[model samples]
Target: MTPRIVILGGGSVGMYTALRLQRRLRRGEAHITLIDVDSYMTYQPFLPEAAAGNLEARHVVVSLRRVLPRCTILNGVVDAIDTSRHEVEFRPHKGPPRRIGYDLLVVCPGSVSRTLPIPGLAENGIGFKTIEEAIHLRNHVLGQMDLAESTQDERIRRQALTFVFVGAGFAGVEALAELEDMAHDACRYYPSIEPADLKWYLVEATDRILPEVGPEMGMWTLEQLRHRGIDVRLRTKLESVKDGRVVLDDGSAFDTDTLVWTAGVKPNPVVARSDLPIDGKGRVRATPFLNVEGYDDVFTAGDCAAVPDLTRPGEFTAPNAQHAVRQARVMADNLLATIRGTRRRPYRHAYAGSVASLGLHKGVAQIYGVKLRGALAWLIHRTYHLTKMPTLNRKVRVLLDWTLALFFRRDITALGALTDPRREFEYAARTTAEPVAHV
Candidate 1:
C-alpha cells in the first residue's frame, strides 16, 4: 500500500513542501494530497504591488494544479483534524463535508488578519491581506475619488477623500505608499482632484513602524512618508470607528469613508480545533525539526506553527514569508528522512535582512550588514521578489508588467462594481419583468 500524505493550506509552505517532496519521493511509493481554501498560493510579498496595479493580481498567485501536476490538489477548508483517527474532515467549495485519512499529516494553514473589537470596524474597515482584498482596495480608493468628484457637499467630499490606514508595518506602509503613488498619478485624469486634495493618514499604536527593517530604516520610512504629505501619527491608537467617524486615543476625531486595516495576523483559527498541542498564542507547537511535539507522524510549519528558532534560543521564528519558504524546504527534508529511516536535520537559518518598496522607484533594504535606500534599494527589492516569485511564468509576467509600467501610465480604473456584480442583476430582477403573457 502506498503511504498517504496530506498537506493542508496550499500557501507558501504547503506548495513549497509538496514541490520538494514530489521531486524526491519515488513514483507510487507515496501519494501526496494538498488541501487549501484557495486553489492558488499567493506570493504575499507582492501584494502591495498588486494593490497598486503595478503587477496584475493574477501574476502574484501560483496555481496549485498547474504547479503541482503530480500531487493531488483539494480546494477546500479543513473543518477539523482528528489525529486520533488519522483523518481530516474538510468542506469543499461545493458539496458536503468529507473525510480523508492519511498516514502522515502536515499543517500549514497560514494566518488571517488579526482584528480587534473596534466599533464600526466590521462594517467599515477593510483588510489588506488576501489578493481579493488588495484588488478591492484599489477599486475602493478609486471609487472614493469618484465620489469626491461627484459630490458638492464639503463634508461628503472630505470624507470620501480622506484615507486612513492603521498599522505601519510592511503591509500598511507599502500599501499606503503604492496606493498614494497610484492615486497621485491618477489625479492627472481628474481635473478637479489634485493629489494634495486627498488626505492620507498612517496611524500606528506603537512608537515606530516597519520593525522588521530595524529602527534606523523604520525612521527613514516614517520620514519619507511624512515628506510625501502623509500624516504619520505614531504612539496613537484607534479608539473607535463608529459610523464612519474615526476617534483616536489622542483626542482626535474625523469622518472618513476609507479605513484600511493591516495591523497584523493571527494563526488560522483551525489550529486550535485540531487534536495537536497548541501553544498559548493558538499556534501548533513544533520542534526545531518541524515535527509536532510528541507526534512523529505529524508535522507543522508556516504561520500556523510555532517552530523553535534554533538561531535564536528561547524564541520562535517570526511569522513571515522569508521564514515560511525556507522552513518548508527543511520540513520536507526532515519528513523525507523520517520516512527513509535516516537522521533528520534541525531547521537553522540566520536572519538575512529585510527589504521594502515605498512606491514606483523608492524603497529601503538592509541585507548582510549593508543598508541601502532610494532607487537602488527599490531595484533590489523588485529583483529579489521577482526571483522569489513561484514559477518562471509568473516571474516573466511580473517583469513584463514592470517594463510596461515604465512606458505607460499607472492603471487606476476602479472595478468596485465587481465586489457586488450580482446587485444590478438582482435589482433588475426585482424591478423588471419578462414580457407578460399576451392577451
Candidate 2:
C-alpha cells in the first residue's frame, strides 16, 4: 500500500506543499489528499484590489481541483484528528462525517479574523478577509452611496456617507486606501454626493500604523492618508457600536453606516480541538523543520503553526503570506527528507522587507534595506504581487483586468440583490397574478 498523506486547509501553505510534494514523489509512492472548506484558495494580498473592483473576484482565487489534479481534493472541514489512531474525521460540505487514516498528517488550516466584544459588532461590522467579504464590501460601499444620494434626511445621509475602518495593519490600510480611491472615483456618477461629503476614518489602538514597515514609513503612510482628507485617529480604541452609533474610548462618538474590521488574526480554533501539542497562544508547536513537537508523522505550518524563527532568537515567524509561502516549500522538502531517510534541512529565512499599495499609483515598500514611496513603490508592489500570484492563467487574467481598467472608467455598479436573489421573485409571486390562471 502507498503511504497516504493528508493535508488540511487549501490556503497558500497547504496548496504549495501539496504541489511541491507531488513533484517530488513518484506514482504510487504516496497518495496525497488535500481537504479544505472552500474549493478555492484566496490570494489575500490582492484582496484590496478585489474590493476596489480593480481585479475580478475570480482572478484572485486559485481553484484547488484545477491546480492539484493529481491529488485527491476533498471539499470538507477537518472535524477532528485522532493522532493515536492516525486517522482524521472530516465533515464534507454536504454529508456525514467520515474517517481516513494517514501515514502523514500536514496541518495548515490557516487563521481567522480576531474580533473583539464590542457591542453591535457581530451584526454591523464586516471583516476584510475572504473573497466573499471583499465582493460584499464593494457592493455595500456603492449601495451606501446610493442610499446617501436618495435620502433627503440629513441624519440618514450623513450616516450613509460615513465610513469607519478599524485596525491599521497592512490589510486595514490597503483596504481603506483602495476602497476610498474607488469611492472617490465613483462619486462622479453620483451627482448629489461630492467626494468631500464622504467621511472616512481610520482608527488604530496603537500610536503607529503599518508596524511591519517601521516608524518612518508608518508616519509617511499616516501623512499620506491625512493628506487625502482621511481622519487618522491614533491611540484610539473602539468602545462600542450600539444601535449604529460608534463610541470611541477617547470620548468621540459618531453614527456610520459602514464599519470595517481588519484588526488581526488568531490561529484556527480547529487546531486546539485536535490532540496536537499547542503553544500558549493556541498554535501548534512546530519545530524549525516544520514538524509538530513529539509527533514524527505529523507536520504543521502557516498561520496555524508556531514555527520558530532561527534568525530571530526567541521569536516565531511572523504570520504573513511571505512567510507562509516560503514555509510551505521548506516544509515539503523536509517532509520528503524525513521519509527518504535523508538529512532534513531546517527552515530558516530572514525577513525580506514589506510592500503595501495605497490606492492607485501610490504605495510604500522597504526591500533589502532600501525604502521606496509614491508611484515607484506602487509599481514595485504590483510587479511583485503579480509574479507571486499562483498559476499562469490567473496571472494573465489579472493583468488583463488591470489593462482594461486603465482605459475604462471604474465600474461602480452595485449588485445588492445578490445577497438575497429570491427577494424580488418572492415579491413578484405574491403581488403579480400568474398569466396561466387565465387558461
Candidate 3:
C-alpha cells in the first residue's frame, strides 16, 4: 500500500501543499488527500474588493477540485484528530462521523472570525471573512438606501444611512475606504440621497489604523480617510449595538443599521480539540520547518500553525496571505524530504512590507523601505495580489474586472433574494402555479 498523506483544512496552505505534492510525488508513490469544509479556497485579500463591487465574488475563490486534480479532495471539516491511532474524525453536512486513517497528517485548519461579547452584536454584526458575508453586506448597504428613500420616518432614515466598522486593521481600513467610496458613488444614482446623508464610521481601539504599514503610513492613512469624510474614531471601543443603538465606550451612542466586524481572527477550534500543543491563541506550535512538536508524522502551517519565525528568533510567523503562501511551499518540500530521506530545511523569511487599497484610485504600500501612496500604491496593490492570486484563470478574470471597472459604473445591484431562492419558489408555488385539486 502507498503511504497515506492526509491534510486538514483546504485553505491556502492545504491547497498549495496538495499542488506541490502532486508535482513532486509520482502517481503511485504516495496517496495524497485534502480535506476542507468548503469546496472553494477563498482568496481573502480580494474580499474587500468583492464587497466594494470591484471584483466578481466568484472570481476571488478557487475550486479545490480544479486546483488539486491529483489529490483526493475530501469536502468536510476535520472534527478531531486521533494522533495515537493516526486517524481523523470528520462530519460533513449532517452526515454521520467518519474516520480516515493516515500515515502522515498535515493540519492547516486556518482561522475563524474573532468575536467578543458585545450586546446585540451576535444578532446584528456582520463578519467580513466569507464571500457570502461580503455579498450580504453589499445587498444590505444598498437595501438600506432604498429603505431610507422610501420611508417617511426620520429616525429610520438616519439609522438606514449610518454605517459602522469595528477594528482598524487592513481589513477594516480597506473595507471602510471601499464601502465609503462605493456609497458615495452610489448616492449619485439615488435622487434623494445626499453624500452627507450616509454616515461612515470606523472605530479602532488602538491609537492608529493599518498598523501593519508602520506608524507614518498609519497616520497618513487616517488623514486620507478623514479627508474623504469618514469618521476615524481611534482609541475608542464599542460598548454595544443593542437594538440598533451603537453605544461607544466614550459615552456616545447612535442608531445605525449596519455594523461590520473586522477585529481579527483566531485559529480554527479544531486545534484545541486535538491533543497537540497549542499556544494561548489556539495556534498549533511547530518548529521553523513546519513540523509539529513531538510528532514527526504531523506537520502544520498557515494561520492555524505557529511556525516560528527564524529570522525574528522568538516570534512566530504572522498570519497573513504572504506568510501562509510562503509557508505552504516550505511545508511541501519538507514533507517530500521526509518521504525520500532527504535533509529537511528550516523556514526563514523576513517581512517584505505591506499594502492596503483605499478604493478605486487610492492606496498605501511600503516595500523594501520605500513608501507609496495614492494611485501608484493602488496600482502596486493590484499588481501584487494579481500575481499572488492562485490560478491564471482567476488572475485574468480579476484583471478584466478592473479594466472594465474603469469604463463602467460599479454594479450595485443587490440580489438579496438569491440568499433564499426557495422563498420565491415557494411564493410562486402558492401564487402562480395552479394547485392540482387533490390529484
User: Which has the greatest lDDT?
Assistant: 2
Clashing pairs in 3: none
- Candidate 1: the clashing residue pairs are none
Model 2 weakest 10-residue run by lDDT: 430-439
RMSD (Å) of each candidate, 1 decimal: 1.5, 1.4, 1.4
Residues 383-412, candidate 2: write the lDDT tens digits. 999998999999999999999998998889
Better of 1 and 2 by lDDT: 2
Model 1 agreement with the true structure over 287-392: per-residue lDDT tens digits: 9999999999999999989999998999999888889999999999988887888999999888889999999899999997788999999999999989899989
lDDT of 3 by residue, 292-372 (tens): 999889999998988898888888888999998988899899999988889889888898999999998999999977999
User: Candidate 3, which segments miss by more than 4 Å at Cα?
Assistant: 428-435
lDDT of 2: 0.93
Rank candidates by lDDT, best first.
2, 1, 3
Clash pairs, candidate 2, are none
Model 1 stretches astray by more than 4 angstroms: 433-439
